[model samples]
Target: MMISALPPGLPHPPQETERLKSAAEQLETSFLAQMLKSAGVGEMPEGFGGGIGEEQFASFLRREQAREMAQVGGIGLAQSLFEAMRERHDV
Candidate 1:
């Protein structure tokens, strides 16, 4: 009599739901952090240019939001940024 072999189950992989939840959590955290930073609720180290005020914090938040939006979904923001910078300096 011949017997069939069962597949190995040693490699446990995360479920799709788990992965989605983790990704959502990360995005939420990033969004909140960006919001707080822009609102000036966070701290700024010494000798870091201007002081951490409402205006500065708000500006930071805006930039962060834009960056995050551009970053998600594999849009290649990093590559685009690099190309932009490279265009400025040909050397």
Candidate 2:
């Protein structure tokens, strides 16, 4: 049988590929969280339930929500990022 040669620095090990995928997802999650925070999704008007405490913890909520969204196939950003990295690294 003939063996095919991989391009230099391309095609990481399975574990490394998994790590890259996780990192891409995390990056996407962070981006989504920032977008959600900027859109004021977790904000509340004055005299409502939101206050200093809520503001302080709003980021955490946004991050969790973003993570869930990414896990559930969010905005295709993660996939795009993963594919780009794979191509760049020749993986």
Candidate 3:
């Protein structure tokens, strides 16, 4: 997360914009993960499924999937969020 100041003639550093985009994407990922949870995305069926370990780790799997989805242009939420935040970033 180190952001060094750009040399004299250079415009705003791309790093800051990249950081903001990453943050927005992560936010989208979290939102998708929550929605998936509410939709029983990773829910194990029956009482004798993969046991407690599977239950505990299913969330991690769902979140990873959500992150990948966001990275691959999912639902357009991340892009919209990034554009709005970028306005504030340039302010």
lDDT of all predictions = 0.48, 0.84, 0.84
- Clash totals, every prediction: 1, 0, 0
After TM-score superposition, what is the CA distance of residue 69 in candidate 2 from its true location, in Å? Answer: 0.3
Candidate 2 residue spans exceeding 4 A from truth: 1-11
Model 3's alpha-carbon lDDT is 0.84
lDDT, candidate 1, residue 84?
44
Go through the candidates in order and give the C-alpha RMSD of each one to the true structure.
15.2, 6.1, 3.9
Give stretches of model 3 more than 4 Å off.
1-11
Task: State candidate 3's TM-score.
Answer: 0.80
Of 1 and 2, which scores higher on TM-score? 2
lDDT of 2 by residue, 7-80 (tens): 86666788757966898899999999999998997887767876678887888899999999999999999999
For model 1, the stretches where C-alpha displacement exceeds 4 angstroms are 1-14, 44-91
Cα lDDT over the full model 2: 0.84
